[model samples]
Target chain A: MHRIGDAPKVRRALVSAAVILSALFLLLPLVAIFAQAFSAGADVFWRNITQPDTLSAIGLTLFITVLTIPVNLVFGVALAWLVTRFRFPGRRLLQTLIDIPFAVSPVVAGLVYLLLYGRNGWIGGWLDTHDIQLMFAWPGILMVTIFVTCPFVARELIPLMQAQGSRDEEAAVTLGASGWTLFRRVTLPNIRWALLYGVILTNARAVGEFGAVSVVSGAIRGQTNTLPLHVELLYQDYNTVGAFASASLLALIALLTLATKAGLEWRAARREA
Target chain B: MSIRLKNIAKTYGKAGRGVSRALEPLDLDIHEGELIGLLGPSGSGKTTLLRIIAGLEAADTMSDRPSSIHFGDRDVTHLHVRDRRIGFVFQHYALFMHMSVFDNVAFGLTALPRKQRPSSGEIRARVQRLLEMVQLESLANRYPAQLSGGQQQRVSLARALALRPDVLLLDEPFGALDAKVRQELRRWLRHLHDELNFTSVFVTHDQEEALELSDRVVVMSNGRIEQIDSPEVLYRSPANRFVFEFLGDVNRLEGHVHDGTLTCGDARLDVDLDEGSHELLLRPHEIKLDEHPTELAHLPVTITAIAPVGAEVRVELEADWLAEPWLATIRHADFERLRIKRGQRLYAIPRQWHQFPAANQRSIASETMS
Candidate 1:
């Protein structure tokens, strides 16, 4: 019996090794940034935090992330429900299209936004004629972030919704439940945990987004600059301590996201047990 | 309430894709408060009939019957499953993974109109009562995943019965459980049926389970009903050969019948006869081994094989004057007392010759399938 399960131990060892290697490989740059930030004295760190422009960048970044993630969540769950629960014309195409953001380069996503909503672009030109500004603004930065992170929640929810099924809904219907009651009392509770997981993933992806935001954001020092872009701008201006201080904060946030997600799943398992 | 199915059938796919019939045109009546077991092998359309009753499925010609299912004063054949008030227990339990056992049971109850929803306290009391009915009161706070398979099914049973459904349908409720658990649940279910007596329809392939648990077992073969009778009647007097062979072990003797008597193998017997070639039916337990005939003449035969099964021994024999195999069962003690050994010459005496008329004979072709 022990001999039969020994193969699983070997597989576990290989997977653990691969995971550790990949984690270190991915996390080193962020670690290096934090290390560089700490290289300087405390006075430089104070200078970085107290700077009004830096404070504004951090505020704007947090604001955009909070705003964009929920948008992604709404669209993602809708997209997931549309794809998994119903079969319609172009369903396969719609499924692939929902995931296109995952494969698309963030910069390309920014360009698509530009072609549609830039100052000289389709809707942009019309809006601008009436003094309505979308580009070089906070809303524009959020739009780009939403486009790049749209797939995260849907990706997490699609397989879950597909597996959990619509049986309970049918059961509810046979029990004389109306549509909304069926969804609220039957479907929603079933998908609640998966939806929470999707929301978490969307928040993580939204907060960490960088490149697409760079092109769409005009990088106005105190207005459009997100944390990652601010770090870049500060680094280029030779404010090394400020750059690393901000980078460390982001690194901490990313670490917390991973730990929270893991903790959530562990707690879920325990509750189920 | 009465379920009247008239020429009800179902077909899959369009003409170009090659049509497949899931159910053929058939008629049936299911009365209220009756526990009807649809017994069949897989793909026999028993499930289709249940689904049709539950309003989950619509038969092609069912719409044409203007009067199909009359639940009290209402016509429900064309209604959606939502309006059918049918409680279904799926084989997998289908309990919502995220919901606690109580919540799972309370889901259907909560689906009522806002004004009709029981008070929170009332709902809790009702749920607790149902959980107790299924003997799962202690597990009420636990979610479905936390329970064992038996417990999950019990919770599912509690949930299905929570709303006081007009009809309860179970698609092989214990089909997924282990033997001991299946047997235990069978007793509990039988008790529940007697207590509440909700109109129940269950589909099963287990012959013993159908016989033991159902008020009446409807044996189906190839999407057709072979027989519908109580277990005792089904065993003692089967409607056809398919029913006889399906309900228990049987020994078929090949021979022709004339003038109400059939010479079956080496045994001459009286039987009901109509016309054409005929045969006689004999169950293994109905046959006895004797050195000399008491009433019927003993047929000396070679004991080909002896198989011991727990407390019983099955002896296979071939008579010299007959071109068919004969079998008889004896208790382990009886087998030992008789000193049965393989390849030994013995005498076989059948206590009764069951008549195989044309209707039951039409089922012999199906017994090959059984």
Candidate 2:
């Protein structure tokens, strides 16, 4: 009953079907974005970038991304080390809480932050007296980006840290290394590549955040709007050239991220070598 | 070197927990400049004992030694594992995957304090010398993953000895290598011991390895020290049943003693003393397998199985003597001289009266049932 068909041919057919489906799912949106970007000429792209509103929006988005990425990178790795390496009470609960942004919709994460930092909300009255604004401000936009991308670094680093055998540290300590030295000399070198890989991934996610930043940003045209929101605003104002141009800029970041991922693979191969 | 443990017990968890005991109380004295083999099956507390001796673990109590280990009077039990100055080679070698073999061997020197530590040149010289000792100087620049299993083990050994530790603890050092590699390393380890003469304690279940390598073998079973004797002393005269069975193969014959000689239905055996409700233990090769019998424990037997293992051949014998089954071993030359056959009847005789304190008496009856 099992010998009716050739096994290798069936396996190839199934594998190719999976490969094609995966390619269509991941590459379709990039194809559409590229198609839209090149639909207009470089002259139209330059015209959009020169517009005052488009320029401010681009500056604002890059500013928020530059602010948010390092914070998320440091914050994510610290949390990853804490949750994975230490024995602490409420560790399981904290692990689940750290992953809440991944489980919740980005819109909901933005709303939760907005409610906490709004004019009449908790911690908002004190800030109001100090003339500090978060909701509808660049602070709120950056905060929303942080919330959405919080788990990326930890999700990458924790398993790598855990998988590194504890014997090296034990051996170090037995060899007269102090606890700090053990962590520095043995633990750090072992996980440095993986930790750097995680930082790269988290920074990419923080810079590319869209839905959460848009909800908290209040869609301020030139001040608080990020790149994704800028693209949408340009589209609604019957500015197809500006919208596609900004979209192409975000796609460039994506391409850089893909290149970084490829570089990371090469580094990994060299490490194994 | 020169260690002592008093009433050392290690119980893992609560009584109602899955395993009640990891190790029971034990007392041991390890001499300086002598290699001791801790022999046991798996889960037999050999590793736990080695860890305790290295001060990597705290015994539940050590009143005699103040819960401490003293390498020439430096109390190290309460000190953290780093300050103990004991070298350890784990079963997996545990070499740093990222570091070169030179750096791995230099790790301990790099880990030492400023005033107490050796200089960079001194560390390099020491690593080179240790690498030469392990015969791994050619592979010093390579990482651990690039080396063979034996080479990795040698690097681990080099790293451990780099510290010039007072004592070395090896937890099944050759257990990870292949059988042929294990045999070669076993000889290399013995040669290295003669060259350096460091106080070493190794744990292994391979009796042949224990006998061939160490000056003394400490046979452990059920978390306690069953017997500690020299390799020759242990094989020629085992202390108990577990030691006898664990060390090598044995054949048993049941008999009762009238006066000072053991008597069965068709056989009478000479013994050092009277034996009642006792079983006789004998080694197979020591027995004489000849058809023209003598007056003794002789039985008309047939060969059931013939297994030729290198120089020795284990000839399983089934006899119409009285009660149960028996096995006998003969050298290749002896089996050839006797012309033993599978179905032909032959006289199975005792080589000598090999007796010891009997354990597993109930299990002997149960063995027949099986």
Report, for all candidates in order, the number of backbone clashes: 1, 0
What are the fnat scores of the candidates, in the order listed? 0.82, 0.82
* Model 1: colliding residue pairs: A173-B82
Tens digits of per-residue lDDT, candidate 1, A60-145, equal 88898889877887888788888988867798999889878888899998888888888889999999899988878888888888
Q: Say what the RMSD of model 1 is.
A: 5.4
TM-score of each: 0.81, 0.85
User: Which parts of model 2 have CA positions greater than 4 angstroms off?
Assistant: A1-28, A50-98, A117-144, A161-163, A270-273, B14-16, B58-66, B114-117, B254-276, B320-327, B353-370
Interface RMSD values for the candidates, listed in order?
A: 1.5, 1.1
- lDDT of candidate 2 at residue B50, scale 0 to 100: 87
lDDT per residue, candidate 2, B48-147, as tens digits?
8888877677777635544445655666667778777888998998889889999999999998878889889988888999998888899889999999
Candidate 2, residue B55: how far the Cα is off, in Å = 4.3
Candidate 1 per-residue lDDT over residues B1-370, each given as its tens digit: 4556667777766678798788767777777777889998888788888888888777776455543665666778778888787789988888877789999899888878889899999999999999988888898888787899999999888888888887789999999999999999999988898799787889998998998888888888877778777888787777886777778777776656667545655655444555446666677877777655444334577888899977788888887566667778878876877788877776666666565555654332211100
Q: How much of the true contact map at the interface does candidate 2 reproduce, as a fraction?
A: 0.82
